[model samples]
Target: MALVAFSAVIPLMTVVNYSVQDIFGPGQRYFIGVDWFREALRDPEVHGAFLRQLAFSGIVLAIEIPLGVAVALLLPKAGWKSSLAIVILALPLLIPFNVVGTIWQVYARPEIGFLGRVLNDIGIDFNYTGDAVSAWATIVLMDVWHWTPLVALLAFAGLRSIPDAYYQAARIDGAGRLAVFRFIELPKMKSVLTIAVLLRFMDSFMIYTEPFVVTGGGPGSATTFLSIRLVNMAVGQFDLGPAAAFSLMYFLVILLISYVFYTILQRASAS
Candidate 1:
């Protein structure tokens, strides 16, 4: 209540105020209703950043979800090996997001870095700092390595929750591994997978720090997702009105997408 109001509602009202005003100083401001939004909506560079954000989220979900599910499926059922596997798989998630980016940044340097040197040794020109394609690949790979463990851990929990009776029934039916996965495991995993998708989608959509730290949203503006663009506008350029409007629009987009996912999740659960 009070906490929410102070933290979220108050700040939002301030943004709404800023969105409708051109502010220069503490007391220097003028009302310009809806103008900032119009400018933000019409900006070509903003559109490009939004599209890049969507693409990044799409790629992350495509790779991480399937890889996570497969890894979860292959994990040991029990015993010391299972415990060790869990520990190892969870290691990446333990690293701070910023530090993860720094680690990858160092590892991807074309000179002394292991990944960079291996690629160059193999006659491949891989330079994340200076090449757009390499930059994109490195960032995407970094995200996959960092976040896929989260998805896998969630899926593993879902898999572990199923009753032994279900497996026994599948065995009695002579169900093959694929058939068991599709008919039994898949359906049970659906709820958790839906959650994984939503979490990944929202997080990836707002992704900034790692990519910024690694490539600084560069090799040009090639990796500048919406968050990076928003930061550049709000903080870098000091455009309060436009930045406020953009932030509101950004909040709406996330809300809308999450709502859509929630609708689908509910319907799936109902069916």
Candidate 2:
């Protein structure tokens, strides 16, 4: 715990220090004090990026949660095939983030890419580079493809942990499929699902690598998420002070939402 705290604190403290100080050079520094925070908060691009990030995360959860649960429900209870199924499902996740982006970037090229070629052959003019809608669809589809298995695996573990006695009781009560899911499977899966939701939210909210490599935040900033924007500010533009401040604020927002999710899930479970 002490080691973890020290590691986290050290970097955060360094960023905090940079957030206030203007570095003209190695020796030349000026204490600006919250100027970065003000500028970052007032930036319109920041606001647009944040809204885009929030909406994307929400949409992903809406799709992935139900889709994951459905996939989990379909898995066999016990067999060699179950293990095979799990390994196959998990294959997408084994790919590195940057590699996934590169794969998709090449795959989505309208002229040379296999996917784009098929779509064009089928009479659909699929051009992610020129179309904002196509770009958004590509990013969202890539994220869903990459991450839904994670949610499914977690949900499957939750389902496997559920006692057979619950299903026996449900059968005795003549419970319908929906009722069984609602009252038994879902309730049992609540803890794991909460964890899944929090994990997905945090990951999606901070998504940068895949989209960066695929879109380069192009099609006119359609896929420029918060993390991408922060990188552009801090690294691309070399605006450390505002970038640091924006990052801290971004971290706080994530922390607050995670806390709220935890509290609400706990309360729901308690009630």
The 0-to-1 C-alpha lDDT of every candidate, in the order given, reads 0.94, 0.93
Q: Give one digit per residue, the lDDT tens place, for model 2 in 242-271.
A: 999999999999999999999988887898
lDDT of 2 at 166: 91
- Candidate 2 — what's its lDDT? 0.93
Candidate 1 clashing pairs, residues 3+ apart or interchain: none
Worst 10 residues of 1 by lDDT: 23-32
List candidate 1 segments past 4 Å from native. Answer: none
Clashing pairs in 2: none
Q: List model 1 lDDT by residue over 1-271, tens digit each.
A: 9999999999999999989998888898899899999999998879999999999999999999999999999999889999999999999999998999999999988898899889989999999989998999899999999999999999999999999999999999999999999999999999999999999999999999999999998978999999999999999999878999999999999999999999999999999
Candidate 1 lDDT (Cα, 0 to 1): 0.94
* CA RMSD, predictions in order: 1.0, 1.6
Q: How displaced is residue 46 in candidate 2, in Å?
A: 0.6
TM-score of 2: 0.95
